[model samples]
Target: MAVALPGVVEELLSEMAAAVRESARIPDEHLLSLKFIFGASAVQALDLVDRHSVTLISSPSGRRAYQVLGSSGKTYTCLASCHYCSCPAFAFSVLRKSDSLLCKHLLAIYLSQVMGTCQELSVSDKQLTDILLMEKKQEAS
Candidate 1:
């Protein structure tokens, strides 16, 4: 899955990522910048990060997936490489009306990845495929 941030947002996020990667703390300016750009979405994403709801699942062959436990208690799978998330917000906001760039799940995943706070789980390739398939099935229903 790929991230769907606009070009300016993407560049800013990259800069924030670099700063966090080195300092292990989010710079206030960057945080403020995100808030200025994203409003409540940014705050919700920070809350998700605080909840530690983001997980990175990797297989032996390097296949990966991002799982986000929403406040609603349902797990959403995010394809960070493809910018896909099995969540209604992404479907409705990003793909349908184009009202937003991406959902909070995607933002949470990106921020957690940069902050090095995402929980990681290793599995076999088969297991990875199974997990992804289950998420997709849920989406269909």
Candidate 2:
């Protein structure tokens, strides 16, 4: 069965997808703390540090939104100005209870940026649509 996503969720997802399709590069500023707050996941995120695997996308016209494609094949969206990531770990573990600033995917983006391993791309609308369609198909199956 196909379930409809809420307006807010859909909006976030769309914004994330757009950002992912138009990403240039990870910024140089430190968006989160440098200390390793999370134990296993933090270490694990470091291991999955590959430029080809992760894509940091943001609008070219000064939009503050960001989306990161992690090595695990999951895309995480965030408003860089607000430091919010639309990931389960961010929603359940980071927000509303904790003071952490990043999930694994966000952390991966940060690491990739710092390590200078990010591959910049300008994705077309068709490509973005195709990627989203692929993800939906994978989820449906």
Candidate 3:
């Protein structure tokens, strides 16, 4: 069987260009209008956050707080406010955009959903019971 040779750079470039054109529904002008602000350099960013996996830590009070990897200070924060991931990607998005529902820093939230880790898991038994009671009342209605 004969193997086809790799396409020439020109051919590859054309293919890439086509793919970009077809896949990129957003116009260059629109994309260019968005500034890319990042809190950390790419390398530093990688070290700080995990692309997958959400870890949960529980406080002594039995309040389970959630933690996803956050890129900051050349190391992962391990745990940060779910509302505010300390990763540079999050920082950049906050600085560059006014409304962002999800950024790379929100990977923890995604991971939590995927991994079925609840941010409220750390809540005290009384707190959890209260929540359950509230839910039950809502359901009964």
- Candidate with maximal TM-score: 1
In angstroms, the error of model 2 at 101 is: 3.5
RMSD (Cα, Å) of candidate 3?
A: 16.4
Q: Write model 3 residue lDDT over 18-54, tens digit each, in one string.
A: 5446773334432232223222332232232234335
How do the residues 26-110 of candidate 1 rate in per-residue lDDT, one tens digit apiece?
7899999988877788999889999999999999998889999998999999888988888998999889998777799988998
Encode model 2's per-residue lDDT on 1-141: one tens digit a residue: 233433543343344344445674322221122332444555555565554445544334433334566556676554444556666688777776675545766656555555556556656556655554664565456
Angstrom error of the Cα, residue 136, model 2: value is 13
Best by lDDT: 1
Q: What's model 1's TM-score? A: 0.90
Give all candidate RMSDs, comma-separated.
Answer: 1.8, 11.1, 16.4
Error of 2 at 95 (Å): 0.5
Candidate 3 local lDDT, residue 94: 46
**Which regions of candidate 1 fall more than 4 Å away from where they truly are?**
1-4
